[model samples]
Target chain A: MNRKISIRMSGLGGQGVVTAAHILGVATTLEGLVSTVNPFFGAEKRLAPAESYVRISSSQIDERGEVLYPNIIMIFHPHVITLGKCYTMPFFDGLQPEGILIINSEQPLDLSKEDLTKLGQLNARLFYLPATQIATQVAETELSTNIAMLGGLVGVTRLVSVEAIRESLAERFGGRKFLASATTAALDDVLKSKFAQVTQLVDRNMEVVHKASEAVQEYFIKKKEAGSLCMLR
Target chain B: MIEQKIVEPEYLFFQADREEVFITGSEALKEAIKRANVDMAISYPITPQSESMHLVGDLYVEGYVREYFRGENEFAVMSAVAGASMGGVRVFTATGGPGTLRAFEIFPAWAGARVPVVCAFMTRGVNSPLSIQPDTIEMAFMLHTGIVMFHAETAQDLYDMLLKAFVIAEKPDVHIPVGVFADGFFVTHTREKVKIDPAEIKLPPYNPYSSPVPVMDMENVPVRHMRDPFVMKSNFISYAAHASWQQEILAAAERARKHIHKYLGGLVETENEEAEILIIASGTAVSQSREAIALACQEGLNAGLVKIKSIRPFPEEEIRKLTQKAKAVIVPEFNRVGWLCKEIKSVVEDNTKVVGGPRVFGGMTMPPHLILAEIRRCSQ
Candidate 1:
């Protein structure tokens, strides 16, 4: 693993993109690493385009605001790519060479030939997961889709320990109230009401995470003489 | 809530053991106030500033703060905060962007009244077409409000400055309002790691007896004997009285310089001061400058940095001496007005050497590459 990693998470406002970045940031800090997280500055409305940046390093992080050059990009919804519901143009702008891309989709979405060529030039690695499906199936609620995406992140990178992620989940949901925004707070209530207890909420989310981690599949893109070919891993 | 013991300011600030916490800047503000032993806190909601005050309200609920309430508006909140301060209590309040301008009239009143109030200004863009994004143009308006000003660069600075502001504002010679300004969203919403002193120990309560003015308490007899009322008087006596009092307020901030040095270490912190190329900034602009300097260093260019912590005092002497030897001085700012550059220009001998910006306003983050371009340009 690299000494430092910068991640950009893009999704709709209600999809818990900010929460995923926050939980991952906290988990990194819990592992005694440094991390900073911030959500995009905009009017946060349900289903509106939302993005978040998370920087995790073994040392200090001096930068703030959006991660312009991200080593990893997580698309929380297909709309971010398909419908162009993304802040950055082409949904993968500023992706570093050999960067990692994780998309929450049951199957691969079609990428433009130009984008495929660009990714091939950068030697980027890509993965896909049915995170929302996993969330509804395992946790019985779609709110855990963010957790499932995080599980996919762990399965791919192992950036943070599962123990640290569990503790961060407990601290976020069970400890003192955390407010990313008024809208996020209201969403938290809806998520909490779906469970019987705080522990149950944590446990169910963990189950979603584990299932999604196991379900995540990677795509190996081979640049052939004729065209680019993507094979499921 | 755990029982807290009153400790001396120095011990609480420097001697106490600390623990690291992964939290947003708002949580850091709450952590600072939790150990500040505040008597009262008033609230008004504004973007980027609301969360910090909400956390303070949590402190009130946890019994760390003695009194807390939501005011009718920003003006009402500032007025009520002033009233509470004059009543011999350590009062704290916060406002930003439109809220800061809405409550603008009370800032000078707090200073003139000589009430040791600590207000956190989470600066954002004031409305023209209405922007809720982070901007520091509000700090430019706050420069001459007769209050002491401290600009924080990061969450750690926000936490440290807010805690020390109480001690700085309450000095007998100072006894004035202190506004700790942090760039909104950048320092308010961004989650970062901050080291904080233990919550079991707190700074000793504010002592109103140390105030230069009479406390507005029941124990003191009320007196309203003036030979002439200044309100309607268009005479020399009235003008002279008001003029001298304004001078006194400015002098009070000057008196705070020594206290700032004692508590905050210095008005301006310098790094690699001997380098020919220099970057000078305040607030989050300083953080951007640090990154730019590192990039410049990697490119075989030597550039130093001057981070202005105390903006009101202006650090004129230090800035003058620092910029005198530098070949070029780069001033990166979060606002379009370049108020910080103007301050540096006013002090530096060769104002031509000071580059006014790689400025970005309207809530956009100052990318380090932009500042690096300036550094590379100046290196030529």
Candidate 2:
């Protein structure tokens, strides 16, 4: 019955993972929800690994510690999968049965059915997006992939309003000349695109966040019926 | 002077009668600032000194105090406070060890211009094998920068010292900045009881010399220009300007010394009626020496302690007169062999003997008992 969404964004430094988390924090606050975003980095010089977290809740947050569990995990770099091994596993263990995992990979690798049974042991949903490809197509740089992932995040969680997310992106990146327009276009393009197997991307991503709010309402109903107890696996 | 009511809250007591309640030096600072009605505090979180900032941030958000939380780095935080102080507002910032080292450049700019900026410096060791512990090396290093430095020992002293720093630094004569230095792990994190009575403590009137009002005349403006170094040339004008800057520094130091004496009445007192040996100490060392002096008295050593309350002027005259009759003068500081001890030896003349006590390791508390032991050895 608790409607709390914890988001962890992981990637190499300078990929805007921290920036993405902050934007999400501002967007969630704009929705009148209680939210907090704390960035964690070790030797955060450019090209080094960095991770940040965003926690949003309909009620007050009493636990002021690192997010041990997360409802949504957004991975920005494909190579981070190896670097983030120890860090990622704990967050995966924290996911709820109906929680969603979104990874940014150039080539989608299906979980072996046996491994899938073990991975889906928690009954959580999983999806992968070639956001780097989308970023190259739109921004002509891998940097905008974070923007593409932000769009894909909206597609999966629907926890934030799409309009609010757009405003947050503009506020964060709106001042840069070429980067701004390209990032905005990238976010817009991803939200509107349809994938043959990625029906959730088209249907859930483009509902203009206010309408997206209804999808969250439906997802919670299914979640409650399944009785997804809020416990770290 | 402004008169405000000081509510004697149940928690603000020197000794807590109740077993359930207690507070740390860091928590005491937070409580004192809240009690003092501070408007804004900006600081980046660093170990041995982060609690004060964290408490202020939490209080600001909870509406217990009004403040602006800014920046995740110390450089941005100190710069923000410097800008805020220039706008004629009461502001405070804190850091320790390397954090203080990072902000060293801005210190002279703030002090030379005589900004009544108050900062709490938690002393930590420098470089290489970095530590988040306590020490006095940082304070000793910053001694010559002309900032009024106060060394505090107990939780009560920390509270009183912070309150006194604002009053002393704000006076026009002593408008040169102020810093309250406490040992990092020893005092910054240690818990103790502090009696907070704002009424008992009176803050001096705000007589700022450089407040927004432009007091200098434009018609009599002095102009000095520098030739480009690339040109490799100089003239009478450049030489005169350089000379004038040096003169101004001397004049500022004079004015700062006079003002500090006037503002710090009993706080920086002198007692030389009858004593053979004079001991010079400040901050936690003063408290340690006080205990050592008591032990020296028991051992029948004719010693008197003259704790340096205001360290900017160095209180040269009082220190010289007090030590005139002493057989030997001993100075025990937390810093390694440099700065303060050297300055004391430079100022005190005709002393038959002068001994610099052993250096206590940085980031760790040197027990008063150990200081007493050192005084006994020096007396022998």
lDDT string, candidate 2, A1-233, tens digits: 14668777877766777667766776776677766565551234456666777778776432222355677777777666645432455335556566676677744443334434534566666666667666666545555566667777776665777877766655544332211113334543543343333333323323322232222211111243243222221
Best by TM-score: 1
Q: Candidate 1 on B206-305: residue-level lDDT in tens? A: 9998888888896766665566678658999889989999999999999999999999999999999999999999999888888888878889999999
Interface root mean square deviation of every model, in Å? 1.1, 16.5
lDDT of 2 by residue, B1-380 (tens): 12344432322333224222124467666655655445568878776677677776665775644566756677777788777776566678788888888878777667665667788887777756865555567776677665767766655566766765676566554465788877665555433334555433223224333442322234332332434632223887667765675455445555656545444443355444356666677666665576567667777866677777666656777777777777777777776754667777877896446678645754434555566676676667
**Shift in Å, residue B77, candidate 1:** 1.0
Candidate 2: lDDT of B199?
Answer: 31
Model 1, position B252: C-alpha lDDT score: 95
Q: Could you estimate the TM-score for every candidate? A: 0.96, 0.53
> Which portions of model 2 show Cα errors greater than 4 Å?
A1-233, B1-22, B35-37, B62-65, B198-263, B266-273
lDDT of each structure? 0.90, 0.60
Give candidate 1's TM-score: 0.96
| Cα deviation of A20, candidate 1, in Å | 1.0
